[model samples]
Target: MLDAHLVKNLPDFKIDVNIKSAKGEVIVLFGSSGSGKTTCLDMIAGLVHPDSGHIRMGENTYFSSNQKPFPAEKRNVGYVMQDYALFPHMTADRNVQYGMKSVGKSEKSLALLDQFGIRHLRNAYPHEMSGGEKQRTAIARALAAEPNLLLLDEPLSALDDKARHDALTVITDIQRDLDIPIIMVTHNWTEAEKVATSIYKIEKGRLI
Candidate 1:
């Protein structure tokens, strides 16, 4: 579960969000390019600190104004970014293994790769793989840690139409197989429909 009510004051604008997600639920967040959807997810991932309010994952209180802030590394959150941030120099398998809290290339990690249909591409570098393949590798990397919450921020936006559709399939499988709460941020309603169980639309820094 995720419960967050955060407020961040910006020079040009402000962001305020109060949202919750239950276990096994995929909540997709849609908004314009400058909307705070990605910032909200960043707060949940502990990458961005809220000036006030609280954040909780399951029974754990990760962030609260009254308590100590949890370090980003200790938050145990899986994050897939918009650029699909794979290392250009590393092979897909190695890229997936890098910086994961969960050690070893266990059966579980391999199983996730297999489910994403990227098992064969493991030996290939990010430069050698197609757009869809690199995106899947990034997903595998995020899931490898068995995070408490998975945050995907417009991960398929760079892909073409066909690749975007294909990424949706992998996203769906990950949500079902992991049974963890997923908060996905996107501007594309079509992709959101394909990947999300419930929808949340953001406008002017508020859920609309």
Candidate 2:
């Protein structure tokens, strides 16, 4: 299970949330802008420290008030940010290989691109790819490390309706193929309804 309770104080607000999910579950955090939905995912990914509470992933304790939290990289989380966060200077294949530490980076990159159905665009840079292609590359890169969990933040917000639909299909396939917990943040109710196994809404820094 992926379980956590987070408490954090910001200058303008406070966040207190308790969430749990079994493996293969897709949990969508839905809320308006600045409702702390992204913050919740950040805490899970170890991108932000919680003021209190604990995070447990299966048998591992990722964070706790009494113990030092695991650093982001050590947490084995695959995070796909809203912008896709692709390396502008690198080709799609190289960007996907960035997280890999083993030999045959090129081969592994190509294989991942093939799995994501973007093998033909492997040589294209981020600027040369379309929105869907970039998103696929970002997902491939995130999975290169073989993470225990996946976090997607506003993934479809930048795409047009058709692109969003296509991306949603890809994301759903990923969740089904990988038996890990996926936590996604989005304000789109339609997206949430389509992908979420469970849904939580953040309001005034709390799950509503």
Candidate 3:
């Protein structure tokens, strides 16, 4: 399980939320842009620090205001950003292996590519692939690290309807098979309804 009591002070508002998520659950933070949805994910992932409170995931303490914070890499989180942040110079397969340190990295990368149905695009660069393919590659890259939790920020916003539907299916299957908590941020209520096992609505930094 993941538990957090977080607070981050912004100029105009404060992000203060008490969040708990069970294993094998899909939790969606639903809100409009600038509503602190992504900021919450960033804090959980250790990309941004919370001014106060703490975050605990399973046996790990991810963050604490009084102690040293776990860096983003050590947090054991698989974060797929809004832009599908694939390395422009690396091939799809390479992107997946970027965070992998095990000797079986190649095999794992190939397996993830195949699992995401993008094995054929393994050698293709980000610029050459379609948006859906890029998204798949990004997700596969994130999972390659064998993270304890998955964080998705506006994952399907750039895809067409058909591609969006397909991506949703793939993500759901991954969550089920991995048995990990997934926290996704999205403004689309339809997408939230489709994937969220638990939903939190945020407005002006407060959970509603």
Candidate 4:
């Protein structure tokens, strides 16, 4: 399970939320901008430490006041950011391979690319692909390691209506293929309904 009861005080805002999610569950954190959705995600990924509280992800205790905090790289959680964050200089294959290399998963990475419908675009760079394609590549790269938890922050925010529709299907397909828990943060309620199994909303840092 991905469980966290974190408290963080930001300028002009504070975040205090409790979240619990497990395998086969895609929890959607839906709220307006600055509602601490992304902030809560960063905390779960160990990218940012909560001022106080324990974060337990299955057998791993990512953060605890009494134990050593897990580094971002060691959290065993895959995070896909809003911008897709692909390396402009690298080809799609390279980007996917970069992730595979981190976990000795090179042999199976191509299969994931094919699974996401971007295998042909492997040789193409991010600039060569459409916005939606780049985002799909990023998702495939994140799944290359088959992480225990998947966190996506407004991944479809930049896409137009048609792109959004296609991306949602891809996201759904990815979830169907993996048993891990997924936490998708977005302000789009329709996206949540289409992709999330359970909906969790945060308002002013509190899950309500």
TM-score of every candidate: 0.92, 0.96, 0.98, 0.94
Per-residue accuracy of model 4 over 161-184 as CA lDDT, tens digit each: 999999899878878878899999
Which ten contiguous residues of candidate 3 have the minimum total lDDT?
170-179
Q: Distance (Å) between predicted and true CA of 150, model 4? A: 0.3
Best-to-worst order by lDDT is 3, 2, 4, 1
lDDT of each: 0.85, 0.91, 0.92, 0.87
Q: Which candidate leads in lDDT?
A: 3
The sequence of per-residue lDDT tens digits that candidate 1 reaches over residues 49-99 is: 999999988778889999988999988899998888888888877787775
lDDT of 2 by residue, 1-208 (tens): 9999989997779999998988899999999999988888889989899999999998889999999999887898999998998999999988998889889998998899999899999889999988888888999999998888999999998888888999899889988899999999999999999999999998868988
Instruction: Report each candidate's C-alpha RMSD, comma-separated, in the order given.
Output: 1.7, 1.1, 0.9, 1.6
Candidate 3 at 161: error in angstroms? 0.6
Predicted structure 4, TM vs. truth: 0.94
User: For model 3, how does the per-residue alpha-carbon lDDT over 1-208 read when each residue is reduced to its tens digit?
Assistant: 9998889998889999988998899999999999888999999999999999999999889898778998998998999999988999999999999999789888889999999999999999999999899999999998899888999999999999999999999888987799899999999999999999999999989999
Span of ten consecutive residues with least summed lDDT in model 1 = 99-108
Better of 1 and 4 by lDDT: 4
lDDT of 1 at 94: 79
